[model samples]
Target: MILLDLFHYWVFIAILMMGFYTVIAKQNLIKKLLGLSLFQSAVFLLFIGIAKVDGGTTPILHPSISTEIFSNPLPQVLILTAIVVGISTSALGLAIVVRIKEAYGSIEEDQIQSKDESA
Candidate 1:
């Protein structure tokens, strides 16, 4: 069935929505960051899934394997770079949260906003 073939895509959508919901529904900065990471992971999964090819082999040339499909490696490479960037972004976000906690004494969005309003 088509649904069975696209199962990974469905999983990707589910995780993406969960992460998006967490980011929107959670007030805590840490939780939001975690959700963002989850969202990024889902994107990575989607890309990897797309890069997969049925009955594909590595791109290495082999005369013996004349009839072979090769999966595109570009997406996998780009995802690797994205993963590194995501890690750096997460570290920066965490650092910013720490600074916000230090300055506002709270990481909750509403608390920070109220303090800012009162200031």
Candidate 2:
């Protein structure tokens, strides 16, 4: 079971690494945004995954329970906030990208750099 749990984490780690690579290697602005989104998702996955317990309940009061193992809700709330922020940021980034595409006629980083340098 422990090995399985570790394996699950490896999947999230792989996703994170892939996103990092995409952001570093890709020259297109849209691709970079996608990479950033992927990275954020991986982070969310890891955080929520770690917050889970083998036998945990929600952080609510129970009258008859002798031994209560309630999960922490702070991470969940924080992650929810992060997700909302991430979405808003992503939308803003894509809007910027669209404007960039309209102004520059290209969304590639190298192309934009060259255009700016020539101007």
Candidate 3:
């Protein structure tokens, strides 16, 4: 069972890496940023999935619950923070793209470079 779970995690990580590769390999700035965001979200999902334990409850401090049977909240908290950071990074990236498009009149990074060269 643990091996199966580990396999699932590795599959997700592979997918995430593929997304990263697409981001790096693509010339369109918008497409690259989209791929990057997808990669980051995948990572966040991985973290959340790993934190879940079978038959576990949310990490809540309750009077009846004992320490041995509760789920951990640290990973969730970490993921949440990562989500916010990702959002901010994506927003900043979009803003930069907008500025680049405004200046270059194109969103394709290579095309922009080519046009600049001819000008």
Among these predictions, the greatest TM-score belongs to 1
Report the number of the highest-lDDT candidate: 1
Segments of candidate 1 deviating more than 4 angstroms:
62-67
Candidate 1 lDDT score at position 118: 98
Clashing pairs in 1: none
Candidate 1, residues 10-64, lDDT tens digits: the string is 9999999999998999999999999999999999999999997888877678898
The backbone clash count of each candidate, in order, is: 0, 0, 0
Q: Model 3, which residues run further than 4 Å from truth?
A: 1-3, 64-67
Error of 1 at 54 (Å): 0.5
What is the model-wide C-alpha lDDT for candidate 1? 0.94
Mark the 10 consecutive residues where model 3 has the least summed lDDT. Answer: 63-72
Question: Could you give me the TM-score of model 2 versus the true structure?
Answer: 0.85
Off by over 4 Å in 2: 1-3, 62-67
Quote each prediction's TM-score.
0.90, 0.85, 0.85
lDDT of 2 at 111: 97
Question: What is the per-residue lDDT of model 2 for residues 30-112, given as tens digits with 9 covering 90 to 100?
Answer: 99999999999898888888787778887778786655787777788889999999899899999999999999999999999
Per-residue CA lDDT of model 3 for 13-107, tens digit only, reads 88799889979899999889989898998898788888888788877888877756666788899999999999999999999999999999999
Instruction: Sort the candidates on lDDT, descending order.
Output: 1, 2, 3
